[model samples]
Target: MPMEDAGAAKVGPDDLQAMRPHSKPNMPSPFGRLLDRATYWDLMIVASATLLVSSTYFWLAPQSQGALFEGRALTFPEAVYLSIVTFTSLGYGDVLPVGFGRVVAVLDVACGLLLTAVLIGKVASERQASLLLLLHTSDTQRRISAFAKELANIRGALSEKSESEATTKSNRAELYSLRTLTQSISNYMSFNGFQAGIVEFGNFSALSALYDELDLAFEVCSRIVHGSGKNSDAVVMARAVSCCTRIYVLVRLMSRLHRSAATRSSLFGTVLISLRLKKPASLTLAEAAAKNKSELLFQSMAIGLGKAEAWKARGYHSLQLERVLAEMPSGSKDGWGNQVHKLIAAKLGISNSVASKCVATLVELGRLPK
Candidate 1:
């Protein structure tokens, strides 16, 4: 086994101990955790409870006798009104607290200030989150649009009968750039906690357009391979394979996210049912459901055309791009043709007979070697 693999496999107590400090540094304090978990409704409930408790003390305490409403003893309703006024720092002056009631009033004012601060902080954070999300969405959409246009230009270049060396070099460079961009976008979508946000914000249309562009890129790759004839440049072929494989991984990642989100929604719905609560309709869920049918169809078609099963047979998992490239046959057109056949078969997940037929069709269409 490789040294890294061996180290990963033999994770002993020492390794865990070494990792502990790294994990503890960012741990939230109890109060911080409470604030993070608290919702607006939770804040409202806490405020209501505080008011009720304070009002009860003012109404029942002997020290509060003849303190409120110009020396008149407070009733429960009058006490509640005083609590609200005090909590808001209104100081209407109609009600006055004397003796021990004065101390309670001071503490109540402090609590009011604290709660107000927390409420302001919460609102500010939410607005900040919304602004960040908007910026991210806009940036992502812009990138995707540029990527699609570049892919289209490359596809156009690939279609021309007369290809200059300079043009070929340019196309290769563009393909490499596109592959890098695809990987970056995939990482962003997968790791940045934005998948739900993407769905919620109705960016499925953008994603759908991206998928379409990737499909065009795949077609462009087939053409490149076909035009290379018997003496294809290994570097160019490798680049093409890298591009296609990355696109495949991206599609699978999306499909997996879609399925996982659906599962989460279903589980959450079940919990709501058991708790006798109405399940709130989620924009993410609604948008996902609306887009699911067409997305699945596109995925199925793309997989069928690409031969997804052949990729699985070759041990090409979503994160194993290096392995896929390492295993690719180098410096031989016949070898690359067979690889392409497998690529199509693996991506589409077709039966062996279907795969063979697809290969034969490609061969007849001059898209692959016989």
Candidate 2:
């Protein structure tokens, strides 16, 4: 009994396994695979060939075995005419399938219906995709145009030399507007679909123009800080620097996305060059100058605010420290005092003695603090 029990225990799992139905993965058949891989024109050609072959079969079959047109075995032209009428399910009744030809006609009708349905679906999907692309392009154009217009307003405001209370309030408003635009752009680009669409079909000229406008904004802000001498408006300069940093990061992100797309194809590189979307030598030089100016502005703001340590923590490192120091507004009130120099030296990983000497040279060159 014990031996029998052990035998049953071992055999039970095997019996259950044998009784269970095995399932194969639901892979598509060869015809289904062909349908999926074929293009619209390819499918059209296939459908045409299928219709012709069905007609030819009727024409070649024995007089008594195949379809008859007008009470007689089909001629070649009559066979084609019958095939069309049957495939469309028109049932004209002038042509009649006899014997095994009825079965062939039924199969041909099924294939014709399937291919027609597939082609119709393809047409609908293509139209939908094109409509979506058009909508995206229009939306992008509107946003870019609005962004450029806002930047132009800010530039005009900054170009003024007035120092009245009204002007100050206006400047503050413009800065706020800049921040709002930046936020809008950030939110818009955050969507994966939008990012992909832009990378694939974005207007290169509009993007280039937007970038140039942003660079101009940076230039205007830098000019205001440099021109204000030792009494530079700390609040305005700080706000401008914050906004510029965000814009710069966003620009770099867009550039990186486009660059990655370009790397995917040699054709993309050629297209970019032809469209002037790729930066030329002059544009590259302008970009470098803008970067240097931005750095100087950031460093100047940090020194004025006594936030050298905070600036260092933000991962900003000046490559052209000497030129930056030379161009920076000089004076004790702008926080270029001796003690502040030591703080700059410490945060920038420079010795106090060298920083002092550099300051001395600037002062001797008539760039004295007010």
Candidate 3:
């Protein structure tokens, strides 16, 4: 219909119909959340367990009188297969579930219908939003962004599997270790040193949980090197330790470099030892001459920290890095570890501007991420 035609109804772009907001259905139970938080593998195992339990429930459902199909005698796998086919509405007509299981099958079909309707509606809205999004972006970047999003999803899925694999075999500590490093950095950048340490330390305690998490992790590592059966036997743990050693040395060295004389003395020992084990490489000017304890500490941390910069000259995102580092215990004035951040930040290739802002924020109590 032409809008300009006499007596014709007109609809403007703003007056066009709009889709409803997406509804996130199928929220997990509290128990599911508890499992998810504990370990991804825990989630998988629990779900597998639930499938087994539910199969039994479905199996126990009473048979109906004068029924056409009796899937009650089917095996676990067959029942599950039939359940999937029914729920998806594929109904191939090969086999059917009968009796109370038939009731279960009907309920599943209803759930599937509700889910499909919601998903289709949501997809329509998302396509509209995506069109709006693309209006502002070039074709190339949009494609690139979509590709990246897909890649990220794949990586996330793989990471989940890896996390679960770690949990099942007693190598789960590395999950916490990676979590600690990630949390330590993220918490500090988004929160503060004492706050970050406390949060991550709590996570450590929850998993390693010997009343004192940090102390326990340190003890476990010490014991493993010194021959303790209780220590992590899974090689997955070695990666976290190796990563931690590098990060610890990096942070320790930075703290000493950026702290006062007294602080340097405290952190120097930790920095040197980490470097000796990790063998982080040094950089220009930093390697020239580490005259004092602080300088020496900077030299050590700079090695591991420097390698990261070398790899990602501009990709490291130093604005967040300095904020995270500054929020760490090692980055604080009262931090007991030998500290070295100023030159370390510079060596890690953070700009003078970013370094200043991070330090400024650290010395203050404002501008935490939401």
CA-lDDT, candidates in order = 0.58, 0.57, 0.38
lDDT of 1 by residue, 89-204 (tens): 99788988888888778777888888888788888899786787688778777766776677677666553222466765676676667667767767656553222235445466
Which candidate tops TM-score? 1
Per-residue lDDT over 113-225 for candidate 2, one digit per residue giving the tens place of the 0 to 100 score: 88788777767778786787788777876777777777777777764332666765676567667756765765554342123336445555555566667767766654543
In order of lDDT, best first, we have 1, 2, 3
The lDDT leader among the candidates is: 1
Our tally of clashes for model 3 stands at 14
Q: Model 1: how far is 290 from its true place, Å?
A: 8.0
- What is the TM-score of each predicted model, taking all chains together? 0.46, 0.42, 0.21
- Tell me how far the alpha carbon of residue 301 in candidate 3 is from the true structure, in angstroms, after superposition: 49
Give lDDT: candidate 2, residue 244.
Answer: 54
Question: Residue-pair clashes per candidate, as listed?
Answer: 15, 1, 14
The residue ranges of model 2 lying beyond 4 angstroms of the native Cα positions read 1-124, 160-164, 190-196, 264-370
Clashes of 1: 15
